[model samples]
Target: MDVIKDFPIYVAKKIKHETVDDLIRQFKGLQANCYDLMINRVVIPRDKKLKEIEKDGNADWRFHEREVKFIVRTENGSSISVEFGLCKTIKSLKDYLYDVKKVSIDQRQMTFNGQELNDEMILNDCEIINDSVVCMNKKNGMSIDIDINNVIEKFDENTIVSDVIKFRKPSNAENYDLVIDGKIVPRNMTLQEANISQQSKLKFQERNITFRVRLCNGSRIRVDMPPSKSILNLKEHLNTVEKFPVCQQRISFNGKDLTDDLTLHDCGIKDDSDVYLLGRLYGG
Candidate 1:
């Protein structure tokens, strides 16, 4: 007898073996007349995803990655039609558009099926797998001729300055700086939101291995930080160099919450890493 169970959409299937090939065959059959399965979950690389599935024998049976496709349209009449994992975010689609079409959208206003979408929203929410269309209404902006460390990048207005620093093409650097007209742009803000325009003279500040930090108070600071150092050490260093209060500083690395006692090595912080510092002031 086949080990049968209900699938995502109430369809029934069997999983005799937990291998990649086994899972593919099972999902393929479930789609039957359809071209392929649509998944909106964070589908890691095939090898990695499979490794993870196989590693844990008692894994939550419902936590398998699904394959999905999307059609993203912009108000300019341009559209992006591609397949991605359901675990991917709308921001991922925006990043893809920025990479291929050289255009970006303000996610704050981008919507699908008349409903607004959030950066954290997954493809599953759109219910678009095969031929669904996501409408993009014009709201904010895109990037052009923005120079970073001597290299030029065409960014969408909605692209985060820090994301650009952490994930620029060719090679990934640990840290970077976005400076416009002698003033540093906040990594968290979009280009258009930051008053960055096509004609603005933008510059990227980068060092070989050191990382930079942007405080909440519109100030920028650079540090010669190495991955071998502990987060505690860096906090102490900041307290001395920038007069920042170590105890009052809350630092996050790669979106991971940091403990004051953890080291860069423990937190996987590397050279050129981007560090975000939240400092607390004593009095107004």
Candidate 2:
């Protein structure tokens, strides 16, 4: 009689345990679903749109979201006319290439008006308008001989210092400084701002300092930095390389916290010096 009475309670406890396990599995599945929705459906698209707005300094492009027709020309002289949505990302175009042209994303590299297009960048953000020509080439290591003068041979009065650099240094393009008449030309300065003409001779010099970044995961990353650039610049570079956002990065050296405004030179950070990087924890 006691066993029969206890059997109902025992069954109830077993059911309770199974219910908890099932609930946990369902909760985990829901979390995964939500994460996918947030990242793919919301976050990435929103980021692309925000970048477009920031680039144009207004939301004017949103009103003109029509089909963009452009040419994708391969290095081997083959070409195709692709009509895609203006709001679509370069990644989507790469997907189209994979689907139609059988060009694997890993094997392809693209450039527009002598500037490399990032995967996250939108078509309109790249200034790829109607009839724009996009050059497609096989993914080669950054060994392609680039003649700076030839690259900017068509430079006019409107060309900025950055334009020349981007045209020549397609990879890690930001790390270079333009030197004209033995003076470093400010990146934001135009030819007119620097009192230089299209015929002026210029030099692209990479002014970078190499250092080691130790992450919380016990892995180290080699960072090449311009000594004059601030810690904030380092964080931004890490954001690009490591995909960790600037806001979540906490950096320290010699057991002291480094402020964003402090330059690598200011911190007395030399080549190969170990800088520790930590990710900030959220929600306890």
Candidate 3:
């Protein structure tokens, strides 16, 4: 006669916890007597001590790390699958993209499913589960391509010429004689409105016109401006690049304040005209 004993096989799975303290408490409560434990693809001997199990390559057994897979869709309609630890943060995932996928992006500009992701938020906090799809958008600045007498030039569509003249002095930038399809392009016009495109051809003529902006401190900056540009648009450019608040900016010439609806040409401003700028200080 033969006697056989059969023990129930318990699937040894890693216990997941939100925090290290919780994991420690749960791990301490696990019964150490009369049980077989398996970790890291290695089976622990029944008579082995905890230190011996660790020395046998189960040092990270208590971490109980799990993998989370997410598919990130880019702006260009491309997607990549990224795998991360469950305890990792959104920022860590971004870093992984940068490191592994060669994606260069700012953390502040990252978004998932139309909602911006916080850097400190963990994958679990974002409710990201296995096989989740994340969408990432790139923040692109406005760009316009123009043809200057058959030569191509690209500029920011949102930028005003008054601000541009400060850096690069294009030929006849002041005269501002840019024409498209027999229509004169206004200096204040954005590239979007100018019908600027990579394929569009435009003509430009040199006009000997320049304007000077005199600050309250008596310092002056000379600019090449087309008289067709509006004073209001100039103020907006100053507000953006020079830290001059638009609400606090005042433009005056020849003892008359400039209005938004009027262009420099309408105000009787000609070449080499001097405009005064009054910027007010804002405080608490």
Candidate 4:
């Protein structure tokens, strides 16, 4: 027990406390016990035999932890299940995910309720005593087909989007920095900026859809926007088109106002890109 006490103090002297649980568990798994010595409350087995010298009266196990199943999922869509009686943060769960599912922290993101997982949640706050749904990361399961020859034929020079747009997804990246047909579009652009019309070549899986329409002026309208603008930015442009700023302009996509602050990507304007503009007919 003297050796164990010396080990935690020795290892803790140089290492971080977060990894101490794992270091103690890994090197001493099935060989010794762990304890709730600090603000943490898990009373490990071998800890009882070790000396309890109180540097401060606050050193004690606070929560009577109940063993709960932890399901760790990787960014690559792999998952592993285990049980722990100790309370931990999502970061620790992610470390456990990496250990069990071989997931890299960079490649993974955790989530709940279709939103990206927030690191601020806690077990006691979330109230998980047993097997519970912790979090999930959504995976982009769709892909497209690309034609390099068509790209070269469309433009005198090669464009990155013409070559790679098929392989990209809306949710797969924070934004897509694209140069399409010689136009530079920053990440987080909308379909309108690309001048993508309903009749334009829209390829989903193996299906392609095209749209052609008439504008309020009775003139032909084909979606052919500059490829470098985002839908929200485009909305701002549209506001100017009718002489109103986004905040002052009252409009909606099918009767829903896209938040004044939302980028078009934030409003689910991915495949169909069905953004119908609304507003007063007169007044800039």
Considering every candidate listed, which one attains the maximal TM-score?
1
Per-model RMSD to reference: 13.9, 20.6, 21.1, 16.0
Worst 10 residues of 2 by lDDT: 32-41
Off by over 4 Å in 1: 1-20, 29-143, 169-174, 206-284
Residue 228, candidate 3: C-alpha displacement in angstroms: 60
Candidate that scores best on lDDT: 2
Q: Number of clashes in model 4?
A: 10
How does model 4 fare in lDDT? 0.41
lDDT of 1 by residue, 252-283 (tens): 87776688778676786665677888854477
For candidate 3, list the clashing residue pairs, or say none: none
Model 2: residue 175 alpha-carbon error in angstroms: 32
lDDT of 3 by residue, 84-107 (tens): 766677788888888899986672
lDDT of candidate model 3 versus the reference: 0.58
Clashing pairs in 2: none
The TM-scores of all predictions, comma-separated, are 0.35, 0.31, 0.32, 0.25
In order of listing, the candidates' clash counts read 16, 0, 0, 10
TM-score of 2: 0.31
> What C-alpha lDDT, on a 0 to 100 scale, does residue 122 get in candidate 4?
47
